[model samples]
Structure formats: C-alpha cells, structure tokens
Target: MFKAVINVNYKPSVLDPQAEAIHKALGRLGDDNIATVMVGKYFELTLNAPTIEAANDQVERICDQLLANVNMETYRFTVTPLQGATA
Candidate 1:
C-alpha cells in the first residue's frame, strides 16, 4: 500500500474567485499581511501497488484523466510507501 496526495490548482494565468473572496474577507478583518491567495483542491488516496514506481504511475494516470482539468488547472502529487501491507 502507498499513500498519495494530489493537489489541483488553477493555472497561474487564470483567476480564482474563491481565493479573491477570502482575501477580501481577511482585509475586512484587519489582516493585511497576506498579499495573494489562491484556491486549490487537495486529495488523499491510498493505492495498492507492488512498487513505488507503479504507485506513482497510477496516481499520475488518475490526475491526468480525471482529477485535474488540463485546460485550466494544473496538478502535482507525492507518494509515500506504507508499512505492514501486502498486495
């Protein structure tokens, strides 16, 4: 077993309305330390595969196919090996 984390975010060129709203709210609360905020998606998944390479492959496939919108969003992920598991 392996632990994977998938992070999806809007392309840098795109605008994020959610993040903008949060920024505005923070300013209202007198928090001006933040300069920019961006909204993104986070996913945690557990995958069963024989090796780290296989686990990474599976995560990449899912992210490319479904988790992220290639036209507007970009994604990154990390995989960690798990202990005491059998496939």
Candidate 2:
C-alpha cells in the first residue's frame, strides 16, 4: 500500500480572494508582520499500488484530472509506502 499527500494551490499569477481576505483579517488582528497569506487544499490518499512509482503515477493523474484546476491552479504530491499495510 502507499500513501499520497497532495497539495493544490492557485497559480502565482492567479488572484486568491480567500488568501486576500485572510491577509486583511490578520492585519485587523494586529499581525502586521505577516507578508502574505496563501490558502490551499490538502488531501491524503491511500492507494493499493504495489510500488512507489505506481503510487506516484496514480497521484499525478488524480491531481490533474480532479483535484486541481490546471488553468488557474497547480498541484504537488508525495507518495510513500505505507508501513505494514496490505494492497
């Protein structure tokens, strides 16, 4: 078995309204030192793949096809073997 950790976020050129709102809120709360706020999505998935390479391929496909908006958002993921887990 394998475990995949995925993160999806808006591209640098894209405007993130949620992040902007959080930044403004932080300033209102007296946290002026914060330079920026980025909001993103995180997902943890377990796969029945027998190899790390297979797990990675599955994660990439999942991210591209479903988890991320390719036009405005980018994604990254890490796949690791699950300890003592069966496929």
Candidate 3:
C-alpha cells in the first residue's frame, strides 16, 4: 500500500479572501508581522497499487481530474509506502 499526501492551492496571482480575513483577524488579536496567508486543500490518499510508479500515476490522475482546478489551482503530492504494506 502507498500513502499519498496531496496539497492543492490557488495560483499566486489569485486573491485568497479567507486567508486575508484570517490574517486581519490575527493582527487584530495583537499578533502582527504576518505579511500574507493562503488557504489550500490537503488530502491523504491510500492506494493499493503494484508499484510506486503506479501509485504516483494514480495520484497524478486524481489531482488533475478532480482534486485541483487546472485553470486556477496548482497541486503537489508525495508518495510513500505505508508501513508493513507491500505495493
């Protein structure tokens, strides 16, 4: 088995309203010095592929097909073997 940790976030050119709000709130709470913040999605996927290459391929497909919006979002992922499981 393989474990995939995926992160999906907006392109740097896009505005992140949620992040901006959080940053402002933090400042109001007396925690200053924050220049910016960004929101994103994190996913943990478990797969039972035969090899690391196969697992990576499946995750790439998943990210491109559903996990990320190609027009506005970018994504990266890491694949690692789960302890005691064979892939």
Candidate 4:
C-alpha cells in the first residue's frame, strides 16, 4: 500500500482572510518575528496501488477533482510506500 500526504492552499494571487487574521492576532500577541501566516488544508490517504506511479496518479486525480479548487487553489502531494503493506 501507499500513503499520500496532500496539501491544498490558495494561489498567491488569492487573498486568505483566515491567514491574515491569524497573522494579525500573532502580532497582537507579541510575535513580531513571524513575517507571514498561511492557512491550508492537509489530508492523509492510503491507497491500494501496486506502484508509486499509480499512487501518484490517484492522488493527483483526487486533488484535482475534489480537494482543491482549480480556479482559486493549488495542491501538492507526496506518495510513499507503507511499511510491510501490500497492494
């Protein structure tokens, strides 16, 4: 089996109000060292694929179809083999 870790975030051009609020709150809490804050979604998925290529394909399709907004958000993922697991 393979494990996929996916992260979805807004594009650079898009405004992230939640992140902005967190940044401002951090500053109010005396966190001046922080330059910026970004909010995103993370997902962990297990797939019964035989190969890394197949796992990657599945992750891509999932992210493209359901997890991310193609117009406003972008996504990235990593696929790894699970220890002692079979497809």
Best lDDT among the predictions, by candidate number = 3
Per-residue CA lDDT of candidate 4, range 1-87, in tens?
A: 999999999999999999999999999999978997889999999999988999999899999999999899999999999999966
User: lDDT (CA) for every model shown?
Assistant: 0.93, 0.92, 0.95, 0.93
Alpha-carbon TM-score of each model against the true structure: 0.93, 0.95, 0.95, 0.95
Candidate 3: regions farther than 4 A off = none
Cα deviation of 36 in candidate 2 (Å)?
0.7
Clashes of each: 0, 0, 0, 0
Lowest lDDT 10-mer window, candidate 2? 78-87
Give the TM-score (vs. native) of candidate 1: 0.93
Model 1 regions lying over 4 Å from their true place: none
Q: State the lDDT of candidate 2 residue by residue for 1-87, as single tens digits.
A: 998999999999999999999999999999989998889999999899977888899899999999999999999999888889875
Clashing residue pairs in candidate 4 are: none
C-alpha-based local distance difference test score of model 1: 0.93
For model 4, give the 10-residue run with minimal summed lDDT. 29-38
Candidate 2 overall lDDT versus native: 0.92
Q: Write the per-residue lDDT of candidate 3 for residues 6-54, one digit (tens) a residue.
A: 9999999988899889999999999899888889999999999999999
lDDT measured at residue 28 in model 4 versus the true structure, 0 to 100: 92
